[model samples]
Target: MQNEAQYKELKEWRSQHIQAYLTDNKKLNQFHDELMRKVFNKAFQTIKKQSGEPPCAFLWFVVGSAGRREQGVASDQDHGLVYETKSKKYETYFKSLGEELSFGLNEVGYPYCEGNVMSSNKVWRKSLEEWEEQLLEWMDSQSWESMRYLQIFYDARSIVGEEKYITTLKNKVHDFKKGHPTLLRRFLDNMMHVKKAVGPFGQIFVEDNGAHKDSIHIKNAAFMPYVNSVRLLSIKEGIHATSTLGRLSELCLLPGYKELKPYYENFERLLSYRVSLFKASTTYDEVHYLNIKKLSKDEKKEVKHILKNGRKLHEYVQKIIKKGC
Candidate 1:
């Protein structure tokens, strides 16, 4: 009754037809999200059948890559739970549900999060009030770790049951920031240290001596600045789109960004490179590191343009923050 059978179909499609789906980054993410939702529903139904019923209304939300709907072919579980009431009964039920979902995803090729950012982790599973308290504490602390966690939560998207739980919480965050405009600068500081992917003289930087020696860390160098900068601006502007491209398009409505045209073009080029890179990515680790030696002259030039524009984007966002609400 829970559409549990969809998991098998989803897994088979991913395993067998991945090459066909690899062309569009947006479609790839949408496919991943669809499968994840099926997985979550199956876990919920399976758990409830075994344990009678949930003690209260609860919602499951996805975070991290899944939350943004911007995942690559290989992504892990990053999720959380928000039950309506906090009690021993509800806690036990949701935690059990969390483990089932995580294990279920692992069985179907998606890895468990290395950081344990999954709903199975106690830190990520909470009642609605507890989550509100936790968010407030995180905002108050303003430590590096707190900021990291807050950013993760800010990207969350509700996947199953009581979607408003996540929506209201997201609204709370928006309101908190609205009341505290200066915090954008703090977030800007946290995002400023993107690794230098392209060096002076337009050279592509690579790892010199490691397992991935001579490979470029595209996640940090190529993707993060674009994603992170767009995220900061979207948050400041209260634009609710989560995907990098979606956020950029929304930002276009503001002055100085015409249809989000310029930045979107650069990010689109970068995404195409990432998609092409996936053809050679046999393993998860291989997806985020580009082989500098492999890029043709035009591709390398495009990569440099992406890096330059990304830096420009972040600097522009900083200026917007300084200009204030």
Candidate 2:
């Protein structure tokens, strides 16, 4: 209903507001969660009004890496939806509502997920019962594909949804793990593939080819392995802590993982180091490494030691998986 002039003015005003908010690192960092929650709530309310439905009638989740609360600045949208049991006549209407929400998100600068893992995708938009069956099927098989699917699902935490639905999913994961030890093994084996980031001579390996050439894949090399390892351990221990750092803390108190406390400390240090380096880089697509020549001998030695300990931790995780931990 807005004329062109008013629409352009509003868009410019929003752009300026976002720029000002983001430019102040301390304020933006402190307000990140609050801002995202407000954005999602606004989107939900707008969609509900358009669909003429009660807000509590549907569940929403921010899925994938964002759902895991491990997003980088370049992350895209990955979301899911579950609706209450409704008459067949309302199915199309709910589906349209999902599409509207997805489009609205894109307007707000969250790019659509390249893999179509959005709420607009029927595969991800489902009834609560359908979501349960999908999870059960993935847990039962533990094939390469199944493990891949579960890795994404394992990261899921509800952003906006029926609280019971989130709890139900967590309970299902615990129940499934209780009887499916081999599935755990498969997941661990898949996680071990993350060792590709280490070089043969104990150096941190950066990609040598392709568009990402000469840069370390920080997400894959450092963060994903750490996150995946924590996920595997948490699932085995029946702990539902969602964040990688949180999972490590919870595992420290558990009976069998007492020896892993030092490893967790090392992991935390490496994570902080990587995040700081990434934030300092001029480009988000490239990893930043301190020039070896710029560092004192002692600093160089410390860097090497950190990398060695990280590699060792990865190896230790492999051993634990071999022993069916």
Candidate 3:
């Protein structure tokens, strides 16, 4: 009954304000944070009714876009749990809490992660000790999937519980990368293939067929290159910023990374274009596809510029990392 009531209130609120929030990425993300935090608290209350109390301290941190505080209206779940210790009792406690949190978030309109990156998955629900070991294992593995997991984990931000837990673990990743310079190459390889968004003729690429036919994949084509390149640099410098813009801001301060400053405006423009162009939608996947058909001539020209720059940014970062190596 409590869950149902809260879900209805949240859904109603979202329906009312989503259009306004769509125009402002920062405010939209803050709204997402508020909604998720409320769900977290409600999940806690629900869990307490079943179990007495949490056996120990635990943190619920978001990853992916939510972790970076950059969510479109149709965002899905990407979160994990970090408990204080490695005990079966504590594990059981958090496991239930994790399930409840996922269920609650889904009820309020956030879809479940397709990759099962949510806390309900045991792999993402871990003790502090386990997380450290897991991070080490991921760094050491060097497999494509492991590297992808490491990248996702790097974006984690604690919305509830001790923020230091994530910081401590992230610092460990930084220390590992510093000790093993070759690891940077692996990071580079993991994201080196920037999807081509513009043709040799300078025309913007769009989907060839299906429902989103003729629409550009803004997230992959425009967003990923910038995101992946900046992330690699951040990893190299041990900068802990999760968002691309935030990472660029920190990178701008360093002497070697000064080249990244100009691209900051490019990224800001990209973010604004995304929010202003895409309206609130029902599906998480649809937000990534921007229909060029609806865009004005000036808007299309701006998108082309952004896409071309994104490709250049990918190449520039690649050169920088390779030169250092």
Per-residue C-alpha lDDT of model 3 across residues 1-325, encoded as one tens digit per residue: 2367756676787678777778788998988998889888888988899897888888999999898877887889999999998999889889889998888888888899999999999999999999999999999995999999998998999999989999999999989988898888888899988888899998888988999999988889988888888888899999998999999999999997787776898888888887776674578888889999999999889888888988898989888889878
What are the models' TM-scores?
A: 0.92, 0.79, 0.96
- Global Cα lDDT for candidate 3: 0.88
lDDT of 2 by residue, 27-55 (tens): 33334344445555555556566666653
With candidate 3 superimposed using the best TM-score fit, by how many Å does residue 37's alpha carbon deviate from the native?
0.4
Worst 10 residues of 2 by lDDT: 1-10
The local distance difference test score of each candidate is: 0.81, 0.63, 0.88
**Residue 259 lDDT in model 2?**
74
* Ranking 2 against 3 by lDDT, winner: 3
Off by over 4 Å in 1: 1-13
Candidates 2 and 3, the one with greater TM-score: 3
Ranking by lDDT: 3, 1, 2
Minimum summed lDDT over a 10-residue window in model 3 is located at: 1-10
| Clashes (candidate 3) | 0
